[model samples]
Target chain A: GAGVSQSPSNKVTEKGKDVELRCDPISGHTALYWYRQRLGQGLEFLIYFQGNSAPDKSGLPSDRFSAERTGESVSTLTIQRTQQEDSAVYLCASSFGQGQEKLFFGSGTQLSVL
Target chain B: AQSVTQPDIHITVSEGASLELRCNYSYGATPYLFWYVQSPGQGLQLLLKYFSGDTLVQGIKGFEAEFKRSQSSFNLRKPSVHWSDAAEYFCAVGEEGGFKTIFGAGTRLFVKA
Candidate 1:
């Protein structure tokens, strides 16, 4: 892909329903990141993956939120028993490496939990 | 912990006027500074970044920023404002060798005709 691609640009579900958001990073990008942004708020880091290593989940808000990436490609974020507070734009970004490199962001998936 | 601060929540400027947006960062080491803009319903687009070397960095859309190490500020500037430049701007600081990037509450720019 020319840039980061996210699936289900918009999703609406009732509370307690589980949902999965997928992200396909740009070719050859080694670092992938997930961020959550509430309406009119700044981005909140969710997780980060560097190559095949264990993802850094330090920013995940709770146990209900989890993410996984295979190799250096596709990644999926899963929300179990979604809450109203989970409604936000989930953004996926990829970069060549972790440090000073610029991040290419996806359009993001807008999740709405009722 | 690295953090960013955008003092102004919203700013309005007339078209063709000069514009400046302030940003300050707090970090222990030399920080990786960045400016990003987000249009309505669109993802954030990088305007510019400062890693090292030159204190002044040029970016796309006629934007530029100066990295002042003494003040811990990376303020974005443009000589002339355009209607299309109205958007939410964010300031960010990335930790050294770390995956997390802390972002400040954005500043929304309004360009009046």
Candidate 2:
């Protein structure tokens, strides 16, 4: 891919339903990140994957929020029992490595929980 | 805890006017600072970044940022504003050896003719 790619550009889910957002990063990138952008809000860090090391889940808002990445490729963000507050844009970014190097971002998945 | 603060929620500037957006960050050690721009319905793109060396760093799209360790501030600036430059700007900071980077709330710039 020329850049990071996200699936389902948009998603509409009823409250209490589960939603999944996917991301396919650029080839050979060694780091991936997940972030949530609320309406008129900043990027909220969700999770980070670096190579084969353990993921940094410090930013997940709650137990309902979880994400997974296989190697340095595709990653998925899953939200269980989604609530109205879950409505936001989920963004995925991959970088050459960790340490806050340049990040290539995807257009993101807009999730609307009604 | 590391954090980045962008005091202005939004600002309006006339096209061709000089611009400045303020940012402040808190980190434990030497910080890596960055400015990212997001256009409508688009993903964020790096404007510039600062880690070491000169306090002033240049970035793409004619954007520049200055890292002031004394005040823990990394401010973005442009000599002239362009209507096409209207967008949301984010300031971020990463720890010296940490894996994660945190972003500021963002400052939306409005370019008026």
Candidate 3:
């Protein structure tokens, strides 16, 4: 696709259930990012992937949240044992290069934890 | 540490009127500044960004922003806002060392007819 694409545009999961979100960055772009935006809150950086190296997972809210990227292409964010507070819009973005470059974002997955 | 702040939670502007949105940041040295707009149920779209050289940067959607080093601020402006401009705007800052960028609590704009 010409732009970043994210799967499961909307997802509803029961509390304590696990969920997975996928993202496909713009073709040939090396940088991918994950962020969560709760209602009335700013975008919170959750993780970032550059190439196939180790991802920057410093922003993950807890141990239950984890992510994986394969060969600088597709990425997945997994949330284990979700809670109501986990409900938010999960956004994915990509850039041609890393480090503050122009970003292209996906429409995002609106996750609802019931 | 670097951070961003958008003081206005919401602003209402009439069509064809000028618009200004305030943004402040706390960072050592010159920071990478950016302004992004998000329509309801959509992803963020970059309006403008400031990296170096000229502090004033032009962006899409008839929007522009000036980086004021002295004030530690980068504010977004539009000469004549259209009704379609109504959306949520976010201000963000990035340091030189890392790819992690922090965003401010966004300002929601309403276009009054």
Candidate 4:
């Protein structure tokens, strides 16, 4: 696609259940990012993937949150044993690698933990 | 740790009035400042960015932002706003070669007729 694409535009899961969200970065873009935005909150950086390098997972709130990216194309964010606090819009973005400056974002997955 | 701050939670202005949204950043490396807007049910769209050289950068939708390194600020401005400009704006700061980029809480702009 010409822009970043995120799957499951909306997801509802019960508390303690696990959920997965996917993101497809813009073709040829080598920098992918994951962020979580809760109600009335700012974008909280989750993880970043640049080329074949290891992702920066420093922003994951807890052990339950994890992510994986295959090369520079697709990425997935997994939340284990979700809680109500985990309910938020998960956004994915991509850049043209290297300097990784301005980003192109996806519509995001609105996750609701019940 | 690097961070970005948007002072105003919300602002309201008439359609023809000028607009200014404040943003502040705390970072050690050379900063890459950006202003992004999110319309209702839409993704974030970059309005402007400041990498280097000229501090004043122009962007789409008649928006512009100035980078004031002395004050650690990058504020978005518009000579006159329109009703379509009503949306949430975010200020962000990133490192030159780093992967992590921090964002501000965002300022909600409301354009009134």
- The candidate maximizing DockQ is 4
Residue B97 lDDT, candidate 4, scale 0-100: 74
Q: Which residue ranges in model 2 land beyond 4 Å of their true spot? A: none
Could you give candidate 4's per-residue lDDT for residues A1-114 as a string of tens digits? 988999999999999999999999999999889999998989999988887464577889999998888887899999999999999999999998777477999999999999
Summarize candidate 2's per-residue lDDT along A1-114 as a digit string, tens digits: 899999989999999999989999999998898999999999999888886454588889999998888877888899999999999999999988856688889999999999
Per-candidate local distance difference test: 0.92, 0.92, 0.92, 0.92
Q: In CAPRI terms, where does candidate 2 land?
A: high
The backbone clash count of each candidate, in order, is 0, 0, 0, 0
The CAPRI class of candidate 3 is medium
Whole-model alpha-carbon lDDT for candidate 1: 0.92
Tens digit per residue, CA lDDT, model 1, A55-111: 578889999999988899999999999999999999999998746678999999999
- Candidate 2 at residue A60, lDDT? 91
Docking class of 1: medium
Model 1 per-residue lDDT tens digits across residues B1-113: 78888999999999999999999999999898999999887888999999889999999999999999999999999999999999999999997777678889899999999
Q: Give per-model TM-scores.
A: 0.97, 0.97, 0.97, 0.97
Poorest 10 consecutive residues by lDDT, candidate 4 chain A: A48-57
